[model samples]
Target chain A: MIEVKDLVRQFKSGDRTIKPVNGVSFELGKGQLASIVGKSGSGKSTLLSLLGALDKPTSGDVVVDGVSLAGLPDGKLTEYRRRDIGFVFQQFNLIPNLSAVDNVMLPMEFADVRKSARAQRAKELLEQVQLDPEKHSRRTNRLSGGEQQRVAIARALANEPKLILADEPTGNLDEQTGEHIIELLSSLSRDHDTTILVVTHDRGLARKADRRFRLHQGQLNEDVTAGR
Target chain B: MSVLARSVGNAFRNKIRTAAVVAVLAVAIGLALSMLVANQAVGAKVQELNASVGTTLTVNPAGGQGFEGGGEPLTAAEAATAAAVPNITSVVGTKALRLRTETTTTDTADAAAGAAQPDAGGPGGQAASVTTSLTAAVDAGTLGNRNNTGSGTGTGTTNGTEPARTFTLPITATGTAAEVDSSGKALDITSGTGLGDYSAASTKALVGTTLAEKNNLKVGSTFTIAGKTYTVAGIFDAGTTFGNNAVYLTLAEAQALAETPGELSSMVVTVNSMENVDSTKTALQAALGASKADVTQGQRNLETAVSSLNSVKGISLVAYIAALATAGLIILLIMVMLVRERRREIGVLKAIGARNRTIGLQFVLEALVLVALGSVVGAAIASFASGGIASALVSSNSSTAAGATGQRGPGGGPGGPFGGATQLLTSVTASASPGVIAAGIAAVFAVAIIGALVPALLTARIRPIEVLRGE
Candidate 1:
């Protein structure tokens, strides 16, 4: 579950203050597969970052799983991100030097998972994401765009966080791979009872989300629909 | 992965960079280790030498350190006063004299030939034609104490039969046999024997083999000096040219020949221990009253040895410090570059719940790995090279000090300049001891911790949000 009450994030650009996510408010029930769709300047990623506790808001508040992220110290925010939300990036920002299995084990390592348990969980998660066992030892750079994205998803799921915040997870993949990635993300709502929030500019990808929110000029408009 | 394993694994992420940093650090640290080993070795040698030769004091007559500068000779009575000083173990006195020879021959036919050469106060031959010039340092007590034990008699008093004139050599010669013993230092007897128990009235003498050969004299042969006739009791081989032409006799005999009675050339006072040398010398000086004698201890040689060793040690210390500083600076430079390259990874780790301390610790761990590798190599190289470097350094330093002119003889003899302290410094063997190696390892760890902290702290301040957002 997530709640946003007039969430605002501002930045100083050459003496002029600009608001990326200005006074935006929204809420989503538990186990919801959601997408925030916006153009390049629409602040969709900023909103996702706020929800993931990756950035501090200039004003207002973001609440996730009954805990507010308002005015949390940097140390606490880091902790909140670690225990609560998992993040996936558009470029599949897995550590380039690490193997696929190692990339999946990264978050679990930060969470102090035992090495054996982390390995076992990472193997299972990678398999569930459809990555071949043999390919798990391959470095992230050596993997294709589609396989890299799947490894990123496995890493996001390693800690079994209450929420998954994926920022353009399929932005660098082909259309077919993008659709496949979207399906894999959506299936998690039923398969793992996990809430997933994806930020993308593609309307087609947004259409697959169980709940959709569109952003324009730092404003949010939500659409609740039962998607097949 | 464990933090250590992961940090080690991360080191190879930039293979070229890691290898380069490690190579530079290895050389810098190796030099430092060498200096440390050398310093330890020289320091040990100095201490050992000091302990080996216990403290000694050589008390000479006033202004007798140089040649040809005659001053008031120390009196037998003043020597007695010096013996009363506390901690005085043994006080040996010597009196040297250059005497003119008178005709002396056991053979009647040769005696008749020598009678023509004139006796004492006979004629003004200027330098005494046919007169043998003999220099003798008669012991008022013993020659070298090799055969003599403490006499339990009055200080500077002869342990032998009383000489005609009351004089003294500081040595307390109270032994049974009168034949030569292997103990006499400055001179070695080649044949015959040392003096028999002779009195002030006895005419016995000890002659060097060189003088004996020149004069064709043997034990039982007779020689006369300054109108006194003497039989050769022993023949000795003085190793140096200075000692070769000399003879030894009872203090009374030598004093009678030099016509200086109740006098002493010098006195050597032995303290119980080196620690007590200075105090004993000071006490003896006070006992003797002002300016009676020049109380010189083994202090110069000790000081020379210590100063030489310290000079070498100082260089080694400087090198060690320089090496540590350079290594630290190099490590800091490399670590900064490495942290800058890994700023993104730091952000990712933070995003994954790595606390700032955790991230900083990871970088520091990586630095330790590098340091470990470099330190091991450095220590190995230093092990091979430290000893020779230390020996050469100490030898050079001590050799310079020993080469100075006007150095006193072992016992304040105005004998010659370079008499004592020549053998003080032997070749020192310096190596990397276990303690030194351990210190080097500890230093490596300290450098690693400090080197990484600066860059790691700066990296910890990087915001994951800003990094990821910019990307």
Candidate 2:
């Protein structure tokens, strides 16, 4: 579950104020699958970053799972990123040198998981994502886009966080593979009771989510529920 | 991963870069180590030489007015007073007299021929008479006489009518002959005896090897000097020239023979150690200030030469320290470059929730590992190369024109007490002392950490969000 009240995220570019997320506010209940749809430069990624506690809100509050993100120290924020939330980047962001399984196991290492248990858990997560055990051992760069995104999803699941934040997770994949990835993510959310919030430009994918919100000009507005 | 393990992994990732940095540091540290060893070695040698020879100070007569060639001997009272000065050691005084002598044969043929030729009178007659009289006088004293004391022929007559002939030549002698030991004590010889007392017996003497050969004389052989008959008691060796030409006797006998009884030519005072030499000389000079005894030039020259050598050694030490500092600076620069190259990796580690102290520890660990590895290799290389390095330096310093020119004087004297073949080899094989090595390692570690600090602080200040945004 997450909540944001008057969240304002600003950037400075050579003495110009850029309000990427201006006075944005939103809430999502536990086990909710939601989408924030927006066009280019609509502040969708910036809003996600603020909610994920990866960036600070300039003068507003962002509460994730009842912990205030605005006043958290750098060290505690890193801890929040490690244990309370997981991120799936649009580019997959797998360390170039590591194999798919090792990439998935990285967050576990950061979270100080037992070395033996991390390997076993990483194998299970890769299997759940329909990735072959043998292919999981191959370097992430050698994997296809869909396969690499699957490893990223596996990595997000590593610490078993309550919230999964997907920033245009399927943006680089073909339509068929992107549909399959969305189905996988939805199934994973239903099975693990984890909240999934995806920021995307795909209206069809937004239609599949349980609820949707559209980010336009640095603000979020509620959209019709997908099933209704 | 542990900080050390991570650093090692990172180091191996860029093998060529790491090797280059390590090589530069190694060469610098190796040179410093070698120079330090050489400096310590030379210092030890200097100390040993100083201790063995001791400090030498000389005392010459006031105003340099006393002796030009030969003059008043340093008195016994003066020598004793000088021996009492602080750090003054032993003093030995010497007196010399010049004399000439010739060889003789006891054959009757030469004696009869010499006697028959005395009637032929001329300038040669006068010379022949003088020779005969001198020979007779020497024979009376029991000193050996020779037949060919002169380069030219002698006259055959004393007064143009008297038959005069010279049978032998003149030779020199002291009043008595005695055996003296290293401690300056006269050795008593009961049987196969040394020279008897010349004042009482007046019949015995000691002859040097040269004198013995010249006269074909041995122990118990009788000879004459200045109309006194004396028997040879012993044959012995002193040092080189001084020992070869001179004969010795008791002081009393010498005074008696010189016809200056109760007066001495010179009195030699031999002290216990070299530490007493300067004081003894000073005390003796002060005591004999009125007596006007003059110190020798050789003593003064020895002191100046030693002081000059000490000044040279001081300059050498300064040069060694300068070389070490230059090497240290080179090592510091190389380590700084290494730390800068690792900055990105350091940021990544910090972003992964590593503490600032942890990051610092990792960098320090990397530096220590690098330095330790480099030091071992460098020390080995230095030790193996020290001989060539030290010899090259020594030769370069000493083979210059100035050094060559300086070698003409006391530089050719006996090697400084600890400066012979043994000392030179020991210096080349000098070992680093434990304390010096420890301090050197500590210094290297400190410099390396300081070098890494700038990069580490920059890494710690990097924001994760900024870095992840790919800035």
The top-ranked prediction according to DockQ is: 1
TM-scores of all models?
0.70, 0.59
The models' CA-based lDDT, in order, is 0.70, 0.59
Global Cα lDDT for candidate 1 = 0.70
- Minimum summed lDDT over a 10-residue window in model 1 chain B is located at B120-129
User: Model 1: per-residue lDDT, tens digit, A107-225?
Assistant: 88888889999999999999999998999999888999999999999988989988999998888889998898888998897688898888987667788788888888898887756
**Ten residues in sequence with the least summed lDDT for candidate 2 chain B:** B124-133
Off by over 4 Å in 1: A224-228, B52-56, B60-294, B395-426
Question: Which ranges of candidate 2 are over 4 A from the true structure?
Answer: A97-155, A171-184, A202-208, B43-352, B367-373, B399-442
- Which has the greatest TM-score? 1
Model 2: per-residue Cα lDDT over B205-261, one tens digit each: 556666565567667877654345656677655433334344545544444444444
**Proportion of true inter-chain contacts also present in candidate 1:** 0.55
Model 1, position B143: C-alpha lDDT score: 41
TM-score of only chain B in every candidate structure: 0.54, 0.50
